[model samples]
Target chain A: MEIKHEKIKTNLQKILPAKASGDKWDLHLYIAGQNPKAVTAFNNLKLICEEHLKGKYHIEVIDLLKNPQIAHDDHILAVPTLVRKLPLPERNIIGDLSNKERVLAGLGLVDHSELKLV
Target chain B: MKKKERPSHRNILPKSPTSIQGLDEITGGGLPKGRPTLICGGAGCGKTLFAMEFLVRGATLYNEPGVFISFEETEKELTANVASLGFDLDNLVEHKKIWLEHIHVERGEIEQSGEYDLEGLFIRIHLAIESVGAKRVVLDTIESLFAVLPNQLILRTELRRLFQWLKRKGVTTIVTAERGEGAFTRQGLEEYVSDCVILLDHRVNDQSSIRRLRIVKYRGSTHGTNEYPFLIDEDGFSVLPVTSLGLNYSSSHERISTGIPRLDTMLSGKGYFRSSTMLVSGTAGTGKTSIASQFAEAACKRGERVLFFTFEESPSQLMRNMLSIGIDLQPWVKKGLLQFHATRPTLYGLENHLTTSIKLINKFEPNIVIVDTINGFMVGENQTEVKTMLLRLVDFLKMKQLTAFFTSLTSETENLSIPDVDISSLIDTWLLVRDLEIGGERNRGLYVLKSRGMAHSNQIREFRLTNHGIELLDVYVGSEGVLTGSARLSQETKDDAEQLLRQQEIGTKQFGLERKRDAMEAQIVVLRSEFQAEEAEALKVITIEKARNERFTQDKIKMGKSRRGDVSIKTTGTKKKKYI
Candidate 1:
């Protein structure tokens, strides 16, 4: 098998942190075997991040099968557990990631206009 | 023609003194002065006893000789029945004070006829009344007339005429009629004896048979309209009007402890007011009897008399059981402070039980009374009668100013007694015992549902019966979820663990906060020192630049002076002085 290490490095390079000035952010999309809904959720979040953040974001899609221990350590009782491991303040959100707006807001992407009113 | 108010006269009628035990109170005095009071009821309702009692008491106690006419039982059988009551029927017969005549009417005695009269009955009754000079007369059971009559209309007419004749003769009489479903009497005797009418009923409430007497109406006489509980025992009949004993009769007002502080706090000040009616209802084995017995024991210890009526357990058995729990009733019995009357509900009837209870109450004058488990009173009765009996019983107790405790068994939480003679409503306090399942264990619990004119704890208090009598645990707050019998204590222990956990959480949070604050303070100190150093360096650089600028200015001035040549070689060219 002609496994090209360059190809993997190129992929890793695209995921590297672009700049340090903006809010540092990294998100993980957890999915099980290949299901249509899971695949849709991944595409939806990917498109949303590209359009909103452009070059200021990094995301990793973990299949869980490749790292089962990670799920156990997090006490993940269900499938598809999203974890944000870095960025000054870290957070986690769990689900199929069906609602993009909600996922973005949960990750502090949307401005808290309502809170300012209060 | 006022010309002669021919021998103005008045009817000197003999009053029917309402010989019923407690019925006189309800019916202001008694029945009409001279009238036939119809007594009708279903079979086994103490109807025969009511009629017989009126005649016997009238002849013996009041010295008003009477007559008894029975068409159902023989005179000898009637005599034997009242013998246990200490009534000398034979002596009354010899003295002609009471004439007992049995009219035999066989089913084959009827003859085909379109019209007939009760002339024979009228003749027999007149002769019997004349024979004894009887002021009171009782014709037991009018159904026998129907059994022998061939025409119904004629029987009705003759019955009406017979009542009128009795009224004319001025004899106070009691005529018993058989009760039919939805009908006052099988022969409709109420239509004729409209002046004074009463209905008797015997039923099983919660498995025990109870008898009740109701005064339908008494013209020109105020009577108790409510159905009163009556007991027919070896001593005849006694009625219980529990409500009549209210506040006018003075009570001790001395509070007695329930041996439980929390429960005492629930009661007025510390315990129930003297002469209060307390009702305890619960599922099977929920400690109703235990609570009642505790109250009884408390009364006996205070040197107050207590009477305990048990229909299910024998007196000895009750004493033995109570002894195991540290309640020594034997001492009270020896001192005559406590008396136990244990008998089967079916021994006589509700009327008998009522009579026996009244006799003991009147004779012993107990300060407190207890009826253990009232379910037995509902055995043979329908719901209505059971209610009436209980109301009368409670009223009587209240009137006597006696503290009474009654325990009832409810099958389900919704199995509430109806509002007929509702004992719960008549009582001043009500306690409910129930079984609760929590944390995989079944536990018995008790709570006060109602307490009138007093403050009471609304919490469910867990309790147990041990060698110490009754041990009441703390209230259940559900902090550690639900708790069952075995783990209720464990839940408390769990609650203690929670407190420790909370304390540890506080300690960890405090340590984290202190570390964060220390780091912040260190960063602030470092930043302050760096700022001071930078300020000193900037000040040195500005001083050096200022010195360099001053030297440049001095050189520029010198250059300008040289260009002008104002003092060029003044010492060598003094002679060549020129304005060049």
Candidate 2:
């Protein structure tokens, strides 16, 4: 939780210099319940979008407990899932998004680093 | 009412019947209810089919909606695969009786971060289960999760929790896994936590494949431990719990005739006991098939269904051959009283043969089953397998009160005292047909080697395959010991000739005696007449003498009257006595 707060603070500093990209970013965050991991994952995701995607990003928080049928659409099998549906090539990052670089690379935010996630 | 219907042993875990043909019996009732069952097998060993069938049976037969979460197969593929088994997954899903969810676990497309649980999967499965109110859940090949997720530690832990959650939901679950190196599954841990574990195997023995299942462990219940052969055909998945049957099948005292009256007479004037095992073992050309067909024809003629499993000959060939002996099977076939399942025994392994036979028996519901040439199932080094298969078949038939007839072909060199298949122990009646190589001729001879519970003819009869089926002529059992074929014919003719000659001699002796009696009567009659003539002449002469004596008496009386009247009468009486 403390790390997520620090990341958000850092992202706030970068927001002034960063300009929102032209492409709209639509992301869906799937979680089962209001657990700490989901909260941290949502916070970290919001911070990332604010810094990198700015106002052009759209985040949908979907609690699977509320509507579990949506899990099938995204094929989410793990909690704290982040699905980027905006781009033509969709990407999904599972878990709490604790590995910031891995998540960023997975979401195709930066140039792919050829880091083998497996 | 429901409380009264509950079992007396409340402690014994209640079971949800799978409704699979024979699996429930082997599992002692079914997998532990409300607990996960592990079905592990290698590729194409029917693990997926077993799990799918469980769900389908639960949904359709038990009124229990089910959820099938397949991690390995897509919904379309699974649907198409199960569709062949007559399970309409689409309809079931549409009706909300079953829920099919394909968990696409693409390892390349999935990225793992720290501190994640399988809450998403649980929620998806939970929602599907709730949507259908499923009482059955299947995680088909959940071991695939280990492949997609890099962190096996968390996946295993979450899976364990998932089982607990499923238990809490009180739904029967089936989790399929891949057969590992030596363990029951690739992820060997599933066998430990699952309430029951089934291992499926597809083995190719002697170039023929067979699928078998074994329950590695079933907690809180005693189950059959022997490996059971399972089949997946058009009718879907079925486990043959043949080994689970005991020898407690009820038997009948009612008898049935083998088509040949002589054979029936040999077998205690009745052919075979109903629900009994009849064995006909003989060498080649000894008419084993004929006896089997005869039994089948007789059963069919009695208006009972007959299943003729001809392993060596085609149905038409068998019918034609049987017709040569004047036993026409075509009428029975046309009348639908007899069904012929003719196939090469080599087409399947022993287990498949057993499964196929069982399927046919169950479907046809015959009163009699004839496995013509059971030796066809006797391949290289598989006698035990064939024996077990036949034992199971015989048990099944007996349980259904169907008489089972099996014909076995033995080599001439083998001992004829026992059945070739070493299954005489189970046979209720055993007929041994052997070639009588006597008098430089080979003739067929049949005798009842054994007939349980009734008196049977132990004497060997000259077994003839005449134009009118089988003819059992009494073997010549005189000083010649036992003669068959032309030897018996020749001996009988010779005996008749000897008897005729003796009758002719006796006739001549009787004629001579009659003539002698007639001639003697004529002589006696002539002699009596001559004696009568002689006696008449002699009486005439005596009469003359008496006249003379009377004259003399009269003169003497006259003289005596002068002397003394009393004395003269006495002298006259003395002279008459002298003349007499």
Candidate 3:
């Protein structure tokens, strides 16, 4: 998965252009602690948000280990789970954000090819 | 170290007892405490119930609150399902002693994009435990996560961690899993939760479905290895522990009646020992059931409770049939001294019958139990199963000190030395009633084939089913070899005729002896008369001679009278000449 994420970062950067809509993107990153996966997810998410929706996306990081009781609100099970709470319908995207293409589609920044596949 | 030296079982391990009947004994104390135990079974095999019962019993009975996390059933569904079993889940939940958490995970609801773990489930479980202060936890079918997550590697690793976490939490936990092919649990959950493993199965044998539970493995403890039949009823779940078949029951010296007075007399003037198992086997119409009913009647008459199990007949039908033989089973039933359980032998498997009977016995607490014709249970079952069932029942009854009477049917031509079901070895008293066919007559002959600890009658007594009750008469043993029925009647009549002929001969002999005595008396009189006549005649003849002599003497006397002195001298001279 890490190798795939590196391949996606190179390929998606060349194919994508910074195009932001007026609608604000609200994102919540759910993690148990600052593990390597969570750190990689945070870094990957920042890079994708800045490159795509630089000024339109708002990001909030919630550590489950400090407030473990709060994890049930979104039913977070994985470390580095990013939940889009502001997009009319809430969507949960679990796994490290290293897969930038799937993250872009999950955040609705890219064409929802994942939705079509499902 | 303390466990080895304590000489007591309580010192071994801390236990959380599930108050399910007979289960605590099988596990030696319930699931391992503060550890994860796996319960796996096929669908509808009662795994969920077993897990829920563990949680509920822990919370309600042990004063230890519990958390129930269901991955398949919601709180409402689980509550409703167990409500029928008399578990008030809603009430328990409201009391803060129980907490219900439903983890609703749908594959379509979440998309896998970033690397993630199962922190949400852990958090929710921890919250529920904290909320209830739980010492027990149940995760029913957590394998549902495997179906939804689509990530086996992560799920397996997390499952292992979850079990360790539960152990660290110090709460006795039950993780129910779906049974897999040739494996204890689907997804190999048994590998993670290995402290204790219980397998529940619902099997159909001979058209009867019996629910059984077995302790597949229990680490660091002793447990019964045999599969035990379990019952799920309105009262709750109960397991019929196989530990009862260990011959650990007590024996009594007290005697009970066989119901028939003469039959009692046949059995050493006493009947059966208290808590003894008795078998009355015979061919068709040989009054096997009659003897059983009579024993039940006797027990009821003594104001003792009796449970009569009839596999071949209905309760009312048995009562009426017994009534024909003058054994009224209705009054005792009405008085509650007798209870009748009528079921077909093929209605269920032997295990079901055994567990159901055990449940009934536990509830009724009867002093005597009568299984009319144990042959009913042997119809579709193997010999070993039948023996085990009967052995367990007898042990249970003996432990309770309750007399058990069973009747078995044998073929008319079958050997009478043993019973048909081959359970005679377990019986303390075996009464064999056979049809005595001799002289073209069939009579009922009842005798004790084998009676332990008593001097039972070795003679086969002729038993008749009279209108009053069963009557045992002394059978006639003659040259014809144990004459019975009309043969006995004819022999008795012949003896009476001989006696009458002997009396007539005695009367004739007396009359002849009396006539001989009269004739002898008359002859003696005649002889005495003859002798007397002869004597008189002799006397007459002598008198006549004397007269002639006297005339002559008179003349001489006259001459001597002239000379008185001469006469006196003559008398003196006569005397002297006589002496010479």
Would you list the C-alpha lDDT of every candidate in the order shown? 0.71, 0.83, 0.83
Task: State TM-scores per candidate.
Answer: 0.54, 0.84, 0.81
DockQ comparisons of all candidates to the true complex: 0.00, 0.59, 0.45
True contacts kept of each: 0.00, 0.84, 0.72
First chain TM-score for all predictions: 0.71, 0.75, 0.73
Docking class of 2: medium
Please report the TM-score between candidate 2 and the true structure: 0.84
Better of 2 and 3 by TM-score: 2
TM-score of 1: 0.54
lDDT of 1 at B568: 41
- Candidate 3 fnat reads 0.72
Best by TM-score: 2
Estimate, for each residue in B102-166, the C-alpha lDDT of model 3 and write its tens digit: 88776765667755778767888988999999999999889988877746788788888999999
Candidate 2 achieves a global lDDT of 0.83
Taking candidate 1, what TM-score does its chain B reach relative to the real chain B?
A: 0.62
Candidate 1 chain B least-lDDT 10 residues: B108-117
